[model samples]
Structure formats: C-alpha cells, structure tokens
Target: MAAEGKINPMHQFTINQIGPKLEIAGYNISFTNSALWMVLALVVIWLFMLGGMKRELVPGRWQMAVEGVTGFIRNMIDTNIGPEGRRYTPYLFSLFTFILISNLLGMLPLAIVPGFHAFTTTSHFSITGLLALMSFAIVLVVGFWRHGFHFFALFLPKGTPAFMVPVIIPIEIISFLVRPFSLLLRLFVAMISGHILMEVFSSFIVNGLGSSSAIGFGVSLLSFVFIVGIGALEILVCALQAYVFALLTSLYLNDAINLH
Candidate 1:
C-alpha cells in the first residue's frame, strides 16, 4: 500500500486473487493477477495472429503486419540455427510474440481506472524462470535426442590442451549451467528496474503536486517530463528485452542442434 500523498510503484506488481480461493490437497492453485495477464496476453496474441490467418492472395495491413513479424523471427532463426531451425519456428514465434505482448501490456496506463492497474508478469522471476526453463528443456531434449552422449562435447569446445581438460571442463560445465539463470535474470532485471524507476518518478510528481510552493510545482512539472522520457525508453526496453530473450533462445537451440 502507498503512504498518504505518495505512490507505491511496487504496488502495481502485486498479485491478487481474481476469484474464489482454490486449493488442491496441500497446494494453493488460486488464480492471480499475474495469471490473468498471462491469459490476456495469450488472447491478444491469438487475436493478432487471427488477423493474418486468411492467407489472402494480396495481403492487407493486418496480414502484412503479421507476416513482417513472422518473417523477422524466421530470418533470425535461419541466421542463427540454419535450416534445421525452420522446424522450430512455431515454438519460437509463439515465444517471441508472447514475451513482446506481455512486456508491452505492463506499460499500459490502465491505472487511471480505480482499483485497476497494469501488471508486468515478465518482471517476476518465477515467470521468466519458467520460460527460461522451458527453453532450456527443449534444448536439452533436442541435443540428447539427436546426438546422444555426444551432446556432452558442447562443453569441450574445438581445441584445448589435454592438461587444461580438467580446468576447462569444469568451467564450461558451470557456464552451460548458467544459461537459464542468465536468461531469466536478464529479462526480470531489465523489466523490474524500468518500472521501479518510473514509479519513483511518479511518486515525486504526486508529492510535488500536493505541495503549495512554486518549487514544488516546478518539480512536479519536471517529474512529468522525466516520466514521459522514461516511458518512451521503457517502450524501447520492452521490445529490446523480448528480442534479446528470443535471440538468446534461438542461439541456445543452435548449440543443441549444431553443437557449436
């Protein structure tokens, strides 16, 4: 909760139950605001894709927009993972679109409505961690299924001294294990930091506006200007983070597919 005459930016990220509490034996499976946003994101993606599903002879704006994004991801995979990557396009497309929409949705100015606010699901570690885990799992499955024990060679690199084998192997193993952690942390940190910065400035605006002095008014106006700038930057960050996450996922898939 925010203090009187102050805004609590973190309050926006709070997960509240949307319906009656639900539990299964010893575990609570109640729906939350985070889950609500995830569902909404999926719905938006579906509707967006639906627009381009016509496969018309001549594409309209909707079809063209969808094709453009789809082509971008396809090209990215082709560059990073080559021909074999084509087989993974559907999953990658879904992953990229989902993250992109979810990040953008968090920036929505829905807080104008009483008792309602936009939530950034990706800002949470659990959500990003789950995504990272899913991507890593796919990589593991593809690597082991295709190459068997040869997949272990991913850590060995091309050329290394026999004496350094012990040192290099441990280092490589650790690095390999860090992939999902890095993937999740990167998205989570980028999102949470931007929101926190915006929230801090927002509080300043509120505080300044409540004051009667000229300096306070000036501060409020300045803070609003900064918020606008930060808001634009946040929009860029949202897209960039999605791209980075998708690119990294594709690169990791390449390692599994090509073992390089």
Candidate 2:
C-alpha cells in the first residue's frame, strides 16, 4: 500500500527551521526555504537590472528584453493609474519582476528539490503573506502620506445619505481590512495548488508502473506529457497573478486619492 502517513501537500510549503537555533522572543529563528527563495529572487533582479542598465546605444539583446519588461510595467501603471500614479512605477515594477522570477525559478526541475530534498520556497504561505503585507503597507503609507487624515475619508464615500453612512462605513472598513487577506490567500492557494497537482500526477505515473504488469510505461509517458502542459499553464498563471496583485494595488491607491 502507499505510505499510510504521507505528508500533507499543504504542509510541504510551510516555513520551518533548517538547523538548531534559538530566539530571544521565544520564536524559532532559522534558515528556511522561503528565505533562500527571497535571496534568489533578489539576486535575479540585481543581475537582470545590471545587465539592462548598461545603456548601450545599439542595445544588446539582453538589454532590449529587460527594457521590454520595464516598459510593459510602465505602461500598465500609466494606463491604469494615470500620470498621477507614475510615482509608484518603481515599486510595481520591482514587485512584478520579483514574483515573475520567483515563480519561474520554482518551475525549474532542479528547484523542485534543493540541497538534499528541501521543500520548495514557493509553496510557503509565510513568504507569500509577507509579500502581500508589503504591498498592503505601501498602499496604507502612501495614501496617508499624500492625503493625511483625509485618507480616512476613503472608507466613507462622499455624499452618502446620513442614515446609510453607518451601514456603508462599516462594510467599507471590513473590506479594506480584508485586502491583505485576499492578496495573501490568492497567491498562496494558486501556487500551492499548481505544485501539488503536479506532484500527485507525477507520483501516479511512478506508482502505476511499479504496481502493474500492463503497459504502464505508456501511462507514465502520457502523464509526463500532461505535466509539461500544466507547467506551461502555470507560467501564464504566475504572470497573471502578479499582474492582478499590482492592478489591485493601483486601484486601491487610486481610490484613496479619490480619482474614482
């Protein structure tokens, strides 16, 4: 029979200590897959920007490609959030690039297992949650910075009937608080689901061959083909999720500035 005590697919992505460690606040402080991926993502960003910033007149192929990505994010911000939102372009660009690199790196076969079978960092909610929180903080800080106490008026739509104000204000407050929750859950669930589905499908192929006398090799081959297709789909999803996150952030900031 298959192993009775299989690890939870969900738990595979959780943050845990990598070595013996102690914390002053009674929390575990240890190296984790999430930290590793964060470092990897930063390294990828630095290298890409370094190569792209050479500013050659002829424009090397690598520089051109990087410029395309930068231009795309620029246009997205300009078009969706307008000229007033242009100041946020740098943050959006970095957010999208880091996520794109992290997702793509996780899809690589070598990354599926690193340094003696460690869990992939992309599967961890803590990492994804921290990313979501950072975006949330940006929105709050920028909005308040620009508008001061007037930003609080964002939760109270202008010209609402006095009687309806009480009802609508609370609802608005709840929705605002839920933004980070939605952001964290959406990315975490999407990434974890994709990874787990791939694992299950691959495992089935291996198990089928070992258990059956029939032409299980063909089944395994077909499963492998499906895995490749799913991988391509996941890449598209990674980009889409990143875009959705940035788009939502822009929308929130726009609302704070009373643009719409």
Candidate 3:
C-alpha cells in the first residue's frame, strides 16, 4: 500500500515529453526528457573539449581534466589492446565521458522545477544496448578484416582433439555470441538499479517529513542518511561501470584482432 500511494518511487523513471510531441507512422518521435539529457551530455563534452584545447603554458582546470581523462583512457587502450589500439581511442573516450556524465546528471535535483526535466540516459536499455551492439560490430569488422576466414577460427582454438571439436566449438561460439547481451545487461541494469534505489529513499524522505508522527521524523532522518551513503556508492558505481565497459570493449577488440 505504501508503495502504491502518491509517493510512488518508480515515477522517477517515467520519460515525459519536453516540448511539442511529434510522431511519424508507427513511431514515437517526440522530443523527450531522454533526448534532452543526451543533447546536454553531448554539449557538455563538446564544450569541455573546446575549453581543454586552450594553449597556455599552464593548463586551466578544464584542460587538465581533459588531459587526465584522455591519458587515463589512453593507458587503458594501450594496456588492453596494445599500441595498435591507439587508433580506436576516440570511440572509447567518448563512450566513457558520455556514460559518466549521463549517470552523474541523473542524480541532479533539477527536475523539481515544473517545466524543467532531467533523465538518466543510461538507465534505458535502448541507449546502452545500441552502444554494446556497435562495439560488437566493430569487433566483427576488425576480426574479419584482419584475419579473413581465419577469423572464424576463433570459434575453435588452435588445437583440439578432432572429436572434442564438436563440443568445444559450439561452447566458444555461444559465449562469443552472448558478449553484447552481457554488456548491455550489466550497464543498463546497474544504472537503473542505482537510480531506483535512490528514488525510493527520496520518496521515503518526502513521505516521512510530511507525516505528523515522531517516528516519521526519525524515519526521514534515517532516509536522508541512507541517501547520502547510497549517493557516495552510486558515484563510485558511475565511474566504475564506465571504466568496466570500456575495458571490456578493449578486450573484445583485442580478441577480434588476435582471436584470444
């Protein structure tokens, strides 16, 4: 009953239209909270990059931040995929920055205003799933381009008993096929789960503060503490999830190149 009342926690996940609603045949094309936040994330990245481009003897804060993030991803690609992976850094860099920003932006309190809105773009499976699929596609192209028919050899290791080939080959193929789904589920579920937990606590705080009982006041204080602790955890999760996705992507690319 508490969960079903005016304090419904899941309401936070609703994606509402921001402006004029529009749709084409069999498609919902309206500009929504999700679209708005994506553009915001893109603009933030673009502006930060531009600011970071300033040529001073001592780099400004933006420049330093940009350099640090660039160097971090640079090292990641180098270690996971080797020097050959240098060419692919831009894609991975953008993925990390976009995802990190989206997750952080989702935690902001700006949506309390009536007309304004905020959304967690990563919480939606569509965004993360599409990115995962693209990463997998890149792996396929790189694999086939480098090794041609030998790329299929990845499904069967270099040596195996001929009789065992029947069993091992299918197992390898299944695992390889499952990578994108695994990536999508990990990122999407993490984002949504954190957001849902935070929202539930937020609702508890609101409900408690509104109640007349002393117990409700104590509950509100407890809920506030939980929100703070969960928020710290969520910050770690936001960065960790982005890093893990990029690392997994680099490993996938390495497999494509070397068939590991």
Return the top candidate by lDDT: 1
lDDT of 1 by residue, 40-151 (tens): 9999999999999899999999999999999999999999999889999998999899999999999999988888889999999999999999999999999999999999
RMSD (Cα, Å) for all candidates, in order, is 0.9, 3.0, 2.2
TM-score-superior candidate, 1 or 2: 1
TM-score of candidate 1 relative to the true fold:
0.98
lDDT (C-alpha) at residue 130 in model 2: 84
* lDDT of model 1 at position 210: 82
Q: What is the TM-score of each candidate against the true structure?
A: 0.98, 0.86, 0.93
Give one digit per residue, the lDDT tens place, for model 3 in 38-157: 999999889989999897799989889999999999999899889999999999999889999988888787757875545789998899999899999999999999999889989988
- TM-score order, best first, reads 1, 3, 2
Q: Pairing residues by index, what is the TM-score of model 2?
A: 0.86
Clashing residue pairs in candidate 3 are none
